[model samples]
Target chain A: MTLWQILILASIACFALKLTGYVIPPALLTRPTPARVANLLTVALLAGLIAVQTLGQGQSLVLDARVPAILAAAGLYALKVPFIVVVAVAALVAAGIRLVT
Target chain B: MTLTPETNGAARASLAVGLATAAYGISFGALATAAGLDVWQTCFMSLVMFTGGSQFALVGVIASGGVAAGPSAIASAALLGSRNVIYALRMSPVVGSGWMKRIAAAHLTIDESVAVSTAQSTPAAQRVGFWLTGLLVFVGWNLTTLVGALIGNLIGDVSAYGLDAAAAAAFLGLLWPRLKHLQAQAVAVVAAVAAALLTPVVAPGLPVIIAAIVAVVFGLTDWLGTRTTSDTEGAPLA
Candidate 1:
């Protein structure tokens, strides 16, 4: 399948996800169980994505130059650094590591 | 009938955050192009998918040699995007029930837009913040994507400039402010461990999905525990 085909499908799917908000009765989402689940979902998924991106490469997982950047990002973020600076810090750390070794 | 003098943080946030989001799009455009997408495909993804996380997920999978049109890539992006549905729900009453606003808001219901709008002190400000932020981001994102795609190779060795770490670092930045709650931090730890452990054995995208199950379990257990405590307190054994 071509990338275009995939784009079409993905776009439609994403559009549906957005439309679901207006479609689902607000009552269901307002319920405690669903609301709580929704609240927790974003954090978990984001962390999960970070781990995968940092630790894994393609099909195989390995430690690499990405580690220091992730750690730096964590530290700067904890310091309440701005988002762009946090990204720049991580990138600089990673680039420095690659330069040294 | 006029909207009051812009009197709140929402307008300021929208413009600032919209620019911030646009700055990030450079990496997305460069990455997508590097991953073998043509300039237009990269732009189209930004135009169509519109959500940052999902677009990155798609490009990430493709960069890793996974099938772009395959189930895993599509499914992963969709899952990341489904969070927008939740955003939509929270925003609906605020944006209103009209077809025009509803459709427009649906397109703009992303993390930053929602956050900026939420920070508003009034409903009028929310509507203004949401629309203004969304429009700026939409314009900025697409334009940067084009620039990035065209200048792909010139950027050269994104790792050399720390661009490679950009995605992970950005995600961590997004996650940090939310970690104030101890339970939220625990959930993040659980997810990180799960994704790390699963990455070696599972496919590229599956680990994230697998890790999300941990959150669902955590939420369920807490909910059930609260219910039980409430029930038991209501009726003591006499």
Candidate 2:
């Protein structure tokens, strides 16, 4: 498909996605189970995205500097360091490891 | 009617978030350029399908050659972006009733804006935070994508300098603030593990969906317990 086609399709899809929540009846969404699910879904999806970005290769999993980065990030987060600082420290550590080995 | 101090504070906070969000747009532009999209195409993506997660997913898919660089990538990203649907639903009531404001609200309905606005205690603050973050991120993300793309062109391959980490870092920045609650942390851990395990087996976005489903299950159980306790309590005097 052409770039325009891609963008159009993507935009339509995105608009629909944004619209779905508003279109759904509040009664259904506000239900205890569904509301809880929605709340949980946000964190879960975020975690999933982070995991894939940090760990997965094109199609495989690689336990390289990303492991150490994750470890460092988890530690930084545990220590209540700022988020940017945690990420920067993790990335720097990863880069350092890459430089060394 | 006079503007209260709270309203002013809300506006200031929203503006701050919006400006910060816009800075990220430069990165998005740079990454999209690096991934092989033209300027107009990148701008178009930012303007129309303004969600960052889906946009990043689309570009990532294209860069990796996981899906064809057309509707398939968009579809995958859109599926991954379905969570925003839920966000918009919760936001509608808070969004109030002007056509212009509604359109603006739709454009600004991203994760950061939604979170910031929803977390606010008052309605005025929520509105201010949502619009400010949304608009700021929108502008920031697009401009940054362009900047990143231009820089990418100059540098040849961004991977050499680890420019790819920009997106991941930006996401981490956003995610870190939300990890305040135990349930949120547990959900993150479970979902991350699930996604990692599923990545090898499923398509690009499917792991995220699976993780979301798992989170939903956990949330349902939690909600059920909370409801049971509330029911049992029967409005006891505080």
Candidate 3:
């Protein structure tokens, strides 16, 4: 499928998921297992994304400027920096590193 | 208009949270463009998906894997959005009745809105908070996304700006808040390592999904066990 198709399809699926909560019987959907699984699944997907964006180049992992950039981002996040600032600073860090190297 | 303190407080909270969370849209917009989405596509995503986490994850998958990973991208995005279903279940009572209201509420059923709504003491305050936050964020996020997308398009070469790194950082920021517990931390570590290892062997999108499955299995085993920390400790997701 094309990216546009995927985009619309994904949006529809997400919307369906949201609508399900309203349509489904609340008592039946309140199980603890699904909730816990969903929560942890989010964490897992995010972690995987972080790893891929930082190191993966197509099929290979390469060390580059993104490493320090992400580290700097983590540092800012630790210090309670705002989300937008963290992202901007991370890009700056990576760009700066690339320019220097 | 006359308002109770609770209603006033909810409004105030909603404004603060909405603006703060919507600010992240600029980052998401830039990253989505850098990931190869056109401005219209990016805006459409903000308008239609309407969920920050899922939008970012979808664009993140495309960034790493390209259009060829469309299936996995859709899966990741939809799965990330599954939380909204749970949010909706909780929000149903607060939304009251009427198909029109329910439909609109479903569209606005996101992490920020839910958090803002649940923070209130009364149904009236909760409804006020939910609607206010949802509308404010929807508008602010889309506007910022447009601004960021234009900037991204003007920049042309995405890597020169290190938006790739910025994308990683954004994901890191999202994951950071959820890492207070040992189980959560362990899941993150295992997922990261698994994805890193699998990326070279499998397709781009498959690694993340596979790693997620592996991490979920590990997490469910409770190998690292659970901690007694409060679930509400972290800042709400954008």
Candidate 4:
């Protein structure tokens, strides 16, 4: 129930998932439907993950600097400006907003 | 020892991507602390989880505030991490025949390793590339995490740098490249909107899980829509 406990539990679960790939029948991993779901599920997970991290705050949602930061990252990424630049741009923009406000 | 072109490429990728991706770890360290993890916990997650996407998502859940964010965080992290299972399809047979080697490979099998191996021209090179990238990334990610965690402690105030946004943006950049198709874009949009809307009403971690269910719907329907009509002749659902 504590943070460390949650982390420990998550770690165990993650190890299981990775090991499943190694141990599961190859036939199942090769199947198209599961593969399709896994691929899209990754996209979905990213979306959900991004959405919460961008706006979430202590069990609630709020608009904040992450909005413009994320938008800047998305814009730079689309341009292929390079990965580090993308992260730096977002960080600078968000920090700029915080400094001013 | 002599080097081949493929071996050279693997080594180059190991250094380049390994270091680049490893540099990103500073952000994870800063953000993980901003999200309430101690330096030890942050490093521990990187060590045990060892997957970027899942580690970042777990931090997202923690930032949203729940010590018992167990189910949803694990579920989302596990779902994203399952891509390794798919990667395993390409990597499982190629890496090793022996159980010991396979076990080691399983621990190291990740995006960078998988990419480096597949780019190689031979089984020997693939094996070399896989271990090289995997070990480097593992070491680099953890090393940078320590550096960042130490700095984060010194900084003491996470909001000073707006690392929450930085972390979110960094993670978005990671996911952006994979959204190549219309269906993938649709799934991301639907999941985002669902999570955003649900966050206010649901428990901290549950919104993401709910968004995941929404994604499953989109994925299944998309698959069904593309199913060849001939193949579905006997399928009542079609």
Q: What does the lDDT read for residue B164 in candidate 2?
A: 46
CA deviation > 4 Å runs, candidate 2: A1-7, A22-25, A73-96, B69-76, B98-101, B119-126, B164-167, B223-238
Minimal lDDT window, size 10, model 1 chain B? B229-238
lDDT of 4 at B235: 9
**Model 3 regions more than 4 Å off:** B222-235
- lDDT (tens digit, per residue) of candidate 4 on A8-92: 8877777777677778778776755666676677778788888988888866777888798888888888887766677678878
Model 4 alpha-carbon drift over 4 Å, by segment: B1-3, B223-238
Model 3 Cα lDDT, one tens digit per residue, A14-69? 99999999999998756655565667778899999999999999999999999999
Q: DockQ ranking from best to worst?
A: 3, 4, 1, 2
Model 3 CA lDDT for position A50? 94
Q: Of models 1 and 2, which has the larger TM-score?
A: 1
Give the candidate order by descending lDDT. Answer: 3, 4, 1, 2
lDDT of 2 at A90: 61
Q: What is the TM-score of chain B alone in each candidate?
A: 0.81, 0.73, 0.93, 0.88
Tell me, per candidate, how large a share of the native contacts it keeps. Answer: 0.70, 0.51, 0.84, 0.70
Per-residue lDDT of candidate 4, residues B1-238 (tens digit): 2578877877887777687778778877877887788999999988888888788888877766556676777777777677777776667777757778777787777777887777778777787787888898899989988887887777776656877777778668667766766667888888999988988898888888888876578656764234322111110100
Tens-place lDDT digits, model 1, residues B36-142: 77888999999988988778777765655456325656776787676688778878888877788788789888877877777678888888888888888999989
- Work out the TM-score per prediction: 0.85, 0.77, 0.96, 0.90
Model 1: CA > 4 A from native: B6-9, B157-162, B223-238
Highest DockQ: give the candidate number.
3
* Residue B226 local lDDT, model 4: 47
lDDT by residue (A6-80, candidate 2, tens digit) is: 667888888777766665665666555655554455557657767876777766887776567667676676677
